[model samples]
Target: MGGGVLGTMHAWQAVLRGHEVIHLEREPEARGASVRNFGLVWVSGRADGEELETALRARELWAGLGERVPGLGFRANGSLTVLRTEAELAVAEVFAAGPDAAARGTRLVDPAEARTVNPALRGAFLGALWCERDAAVEPRVAQPALRAHLAATGRYTWLPGREVREVDARGVRDDHGDHHHADVVLLCTGAALSGLVREIAGPVPVRRVRLQMMQTEPLDEPLTTSVADGDSLRYYPAYRGVELDALNANQPQPAVAAEHAMQLLMVQRADGGLTVGDTHGYDEPFPFDVVEEPYQHLRQVAEAILGRPLPPVRRRWAGVYAQCRDTGQVVHRQRVADNAWLVTGPGGRGMTCSPAIAERTVEEIGL
Candidate 1:
C-alpha cells in the first residue's frame, strides 16, 4: 500500500519489460519520503570498486530516464564535500588517494580552488572533495513527470486510493473487494513491512527511520554545487573512512558541530532556493512523529556554519526510509506461495539505486 520510488520504479520497469502492470497507491497524492528527499541521484557514496559498478550504471540510467521523461527535474550541478578542519581534509585526501578516485571523479581541492568551482562558496571553508559525477533533481517536479510518463506508457494501469490487504498465491486483494491477478507480484511497500513478510524472507530486518529536513526561500545567489562538511564522512556510506563502531561511540557535541547534523546544503531551483539540513534518528519499532525542535537545532547549526541566520523557511517536513540492517540497499525475494513471489526493500538509495534494482527484479522474474 506504500507507493513511492520503489513501487513506481517497478511499475516503469514492468512496462519496459512488456509486462502489463497495475499500481495501487492508498494515498491521494504521492508525497512522502520518496518525493520529500534530497532528490540527489548520487553515486559518490557507492561502495568501493566492484560494489559501485552497478551504482555507476544507475547514474547513466537516471540521465536516460530524464530524456525519456521530460521535466524530470534532472540537474548536473555536481556535489562538493567541503572540509572545515584539518582532520576532514585528511579524510578527503584518503578518498582521492584511493584506487577508485579516477572513475568516481573525486579530487581534493584547496579553498580558493573550490571557490572557483562554486563562487557562492567564496571564503566559506578550508577545502572540499569534489565529485562531478553526482547530480540532483527537484522531487516535486520529477514525481509528476514520472506519473505522466507511466500514464502515457499504455502498459501501466494505476489504481490510486486503493489499498491492498492480502497477496495470496493467486492474486492481490484490495480493500474495495476486488482482486487483481498477475503472473508475478512485487511488494515495494516502504516502512510498512512487518509480520509474516519477514518470516517469508528469512529476516531482512526492516525498520522505519525518520530524517529531519528543511528548505529555504529563494536567495539572490544560489550555490552552483552541493556542499557538505567533512563530518559528513561519518554519516554517509560513500565516505569509507567512517567506521560504524567509531560513529556509534560518538554523539552530538555540546553545541552541535556541523558534523552531527551531517548536513548537505544544495542550491536548488531557478529561483535560488536552497534545501538543507538532514539528521537521522531511529526508535525501536517505528515512530512517524514530525517535530519542530529538530528544525530549531538545524537552524542553530546552519547559523554556526554560515555565520548568519538562515533565510525564511519555505517548506519543512520529515520522511521515513526503510532500512535493512547495514545493507547498502535491500532487495529481497519472498516465495509467498507456489511460484508467487514478493520483492522489496531498496531502502533510501531508491532514487539513485532504483533503476538497476528494478531491472534486476524484472530479470529475476524472467519477464
Candidate 2:
C-alpha cells in the first residue's frame, strides 16, 4: 500500500464500486514520482496495441474525473512537439500519416499553424506534430483532491504515516503493531521494491528510472498547450519507423542531450509557471544529487522554442519512478497471495495511465 497517485486511484476505484476502503500510506503525504511529475495525462508517446489503448482509455477517465474533482486542474490543452529540423519533421510526417494518427488526435502542422494553436511559441520551427488528445493536471495536489472526493462517499478511510509491514490472505499488519484485516488487499507501492515487496513477491521485473526537472516563476504569457522539442521524437515510441531511424542516424541529439537522454517537455501550471524537464537514467545507485548540465540543456532548448527567456527557475529536483524493463508493458500487476495483489512499475505512464490501470486491476480482481 502507498499514497501516490496509484494508491489513490485504486482507492477511488474501490469506492466507486461502493466498497468500504481503508487506504494505508507510508508517508504523511505523497512525495514520490506521483507528486514530482509534470502532471501530464500524456497519450502521444504510448506504443501501439495495449499500451496505446490503455492511455486512450485513461484519457477518457481523467476527463470525467477532472470534472468531478476541480483541484485536478485538468486541461484539454493538447500538446505540440515542435520540430526544428527536416529530420524531425520527417518522423512527424510519417507518424501523422500513420493509420492510428486519427485515433491519437495527431496532425502535422506548419510553423504558422502550430503558432496559431499556441501563440507563445514565437520561436522558429519547421513544423510540429500536434496531438489533441494530450492533456494536463496539477500533479502535486491531484492525489489529495481525489482522496477528499472519495471520502465524501462515507466509505473511505485514509491512514497515512503508517506503513504496511506485512500482508497475508486475510489482511495487513502496520508498523504501528496494529492489525487491520480485510477481504482483499492491494499494494500500490511506487518504487520501493525491497523489504515487504521483495519478501512477499521476490524479484519483480521492475526497475527504477531517475529524471531531473525544474519549475520556473510565472511566465508573462500563457503556454496555451504543453510543448516538446524534437528530441522527444527519439524518446516516444509512435515515431519508430524507417523514417525515424533515418532521422536518428542523420540528426543525432546534441552531445549533452544524448549523454543525458534528455527531452524538453514543458507545461504551464495554474499559476503560469512552466514545468520543464527531463533526462533519463536507469543505472542503479542513482546519484543522490542533481546535475547542472541537464538543467542547462533544458533551459536552452525551452528558450529556443519560446524565443524568449524563461522566468526565473524557483525550484529544481530529481524523481525516480519504477518501470517495467520490457518497455512495452503498461504496468506490472501480480497476485502475490490468494487475496493480496502487488502492482507497480508504471514508469512515466504512471501519471497518464494510473486511472485505467486501477480500473483494470479492480475489474480483474473482481473487487
Tell me the whole-model lDDT of each prediction, alpha carbons only.
0.70, 0.93
> Per-residue lDDT tens digits of candidate 1, residues 82-190?
7776666666777787888888878888877887887766435677889898888777777667867988878777788877776777767888989988666777767
Q: At residue 314, give the lDDT of candidate 2.
A: 96
Q: Model 2, range 14-44, lDDT digits (tens) per residue?
A: 9999899999998899989998999999999
The TM-scores, one per candidate, come to 0.88, 0.99
What ranges in model 1 sit over 4 Å off? 49-51, 195-203, 242-262, 265-267, 285-293, 300-309, 328-330, 338-340
Q: Assess candidate 1 and give its lDDT.
A: 0.70
- Error (Å) of candidate 1 at residue 162 is 0.7
User: lDDT (0-100) at residue 202 of candidate 2?
Assistant: 95
Number of clashing pairs per prediction, in order: 2, 0
